[model samples]
Target: MEKNKEVSANNKVDVDSRRDFLTKTPIPELIIKLSIPTIISMLVTALYNMADTYFVGKISTQATASVGLVFSVMAIIQALGFFCGHGSGNFIARMLGAGKVKEANEMASTGFCMAMIFGIVIAVVGNIFINPLASAIGATKTSMADTKAYMSIILIGAPFMMCQFVINNQLRFQGRAVYAMVGLMCGAVFNVGLDPLLILVFDMGVRGAAIATITGQFMSFLVLLFISLRGQTIKVNIKNVRLNGFYLKEITNGGAPSLFRQGLAAAATLLLNKYAGKYGNDAAIAGMSITTRVMMMLGSAVIGFGQGYQPVCSYNYGAKLKDRVREGYFFCVKYGTIFLVFAGAICFIFAPDIIWAFRKDEEVVAVGKVALRFQACVLPCMATTVITNMMLQSMGKGIKASITSSARSGIFFIPLILILPRVFGIRGVEVTQTIADILAMGIAIPFAVSELRKMKKME
Candidate 1:
């Protein structure tokens, strides 16, 4: 009994120490320290996603296009994951900052359970209507079989995948990005290791790729679940789970931006794929898909860095240290934009090479290069857009955050994608995303400025 009491006291000390560090650390140093692991996690996650496309690219053009089409489904899965994870995580951080540790635990527990249930529903329903679902995602006749093969396995793993994502975001919000990084990196590495063997050696084709992807997600889910159960950062227990209106409201308010952002990404991809099909052929679809993947890879780092700022923003806002939140936001935007500038320059220089590296078909390269270069040119603008949305969401400004989040994919891209191709021919399809990024940035500026002014006034 005495030993157990001593251990409990030590755990409390550790927890308090971490809270102090998070609250007291210098803004720049803290953001960097927090961001590095998250950036690695994001990059590795992106790499594994690319690995699936890359290995599938080796199969056939139809196969690659099939993978691309199914990406919309993947996007939706990711959307749900982020919605629950970010929603609960934002509240959890703030609750902790306000010294409401029990409420934070309750939020985490409720979010995880809800996400898992949601995933199960999606998986079951998706499998039931697999054929029409494939057609809805723009799968061509040739790509239909592979799309079914991939989407089925992916949907089957949805529960694990969503749950894993929830735990990961929660850990990061708790200032345990290293633990989150470890879990994600392990899964990514495992996925990469298995991809070639299953796709090539086993000759299981797209099914093999799907299996590998889900296997990684399940492993990651286990890793994260283990960490949370061990009471490392925020413990997720059934007892702490509350499914009431009060908690749900907090989660929705904090997470609505991510839902719009990622959910619209899925919707936009569906439109893009459908438009690509109309404009050209499988090659066109593959080209746009590859371009999207490359841009996402580049953007992942920025998102990860922005996420690092989220906990800081939420914590300080809850603690009423508006100055710290304001400072952290600007710090992330400046450094993130500078880094993207360099990344964009490199991508622009090697657009063709990058496209060809993924899928070596001549038509694919032709279609992808122009789009990739256009996106690279405007990539730096994403820092402002993404950070603004993240900040607004973390601060629980749901309306502004949702508007900012939906701007690029839903508000601007949807309209442009519909009208541009008719007017500008193929060039319209190629440059749609770049135009969206610019317009989204324009929308984000005022939102960011207004919030900053409010924070300043609070001083």
Candidate 2:
């Protein structure tokens, strides 16, 4: 039954064009074509995130810190979604490249179903232990009330947000990034619009911001599912779920890097907030949180560009086209690095103004200005580090990919966030990410060189 769908003339034409487009297009042209939509998606994602921070910042210093505290919880949720989505999407991309469409189709549904199930579990469990969870993530007495209110609502929407990420990622891995972009755009626009309305006009404050976030997630989930069904892309059907050991193992091999990367991000954020609060209190946490979000906005472009290269790498590697994979990697790294150098300079210059835009507290500005500038100094290094992880992950080099991915937020960040503060106080927290970033470069370059050299030998 599924095979019949692919045999239809329109479907066959669609499939053939997509294959040619991924494998035969000029390398630069291909990356740009894919990068544009994914870039837009990432920027829009970053913007709505800023919108939340911007609107909520109006409430109080405690409110802002509370939202920052909730961020770690959200990261854990995203880690699980990416774990399933990437795990399944990675296999889907390679399988399609090797012309195993049925296997790709099965993996899609299996990954989607797995994400939704996990989402439900989070929703159930998170709301049950909201207070203790909030405390564990670094919420202090001043911010506990706002944190619980925002967190409970976000926890309720976990299923929708998780499914949205799963479907969006699956589309990108299938070389349908434009479809993913549109769905994500609609949700982002809606979230941005809803922010002021819910937060200020309605006087909902932190609660309003949380509601807008989850509703926007549900909106994205609906649109992405519609796009998946209406288009000629792989259909995500319940019957296609293969929950056995074989598919589960494949998902882990493909997605473990993402899990480690994002899971470590959650752990790191918890520690950052805890240490900042311990030394400096709510204002320090607020300032550091703003810096974190600002850096995320600046870095989204490189992540978007690297995402563009992932499909090219995975597809060609699966098709045994080593030259194309190598070409795309060099092209991405060269351009990505150049872009970041300029972004870092600009961000470094206007660090104080950027922090003030989020929250006008003097303490917040003092902490954020230093934090943002310190990170900006090392921003250029991230292009190589991020792309290497993406490349290794795309090619199913799980162990190597996980190591590089873990470097930025885990191996280095966890240790730095812990030891630095003991010695330098709040200054230690400000400089930790920049230090971790530079060290991560050391890990990424060697791994990338090793893989590229092996491919050269094969050639």
Clashing pairs in 1: none
lDDT string, candidate 1, 1-459, tens digits? 999888767766766776787789999999999999999988987886799999999998888888899999999999999999999999988887877776888999999998989999999999999999999999988889999999999999999999999999999998889999999987987899899999999999999999999999989999989988996447899898899999889889988899999999999999999999888889999999999999899899999999899988888888898998999999989998999999999989999999999899999999999999999999999999999999999999999999999999999999999999989867899999999999999999999999999999998
Assess candidate 1 and give its lDDT.
Answer: 0.92
Superposed on all Cα atoms, the candidates' RMSDs to the truth, in angstroms, are 1.3, 1.4
lDDT of 1 at 389: 95
Best by lDDT: 1
Which ranges of candidate 2 are over 4 A from the true structure?
Answer: 1-10
For every model shown, what is its TM-score relative to the native structure?
Answer: 0.98, 0.98
Worst 10 residues of 1 by lDDT: 7-16
lDDT of each: 0.92, 0.90
lDDT of 2: 0.90
Model 1 segments beyond 4 Å from truth? 1-12
Error of 1 at 153 (Å): 0.8
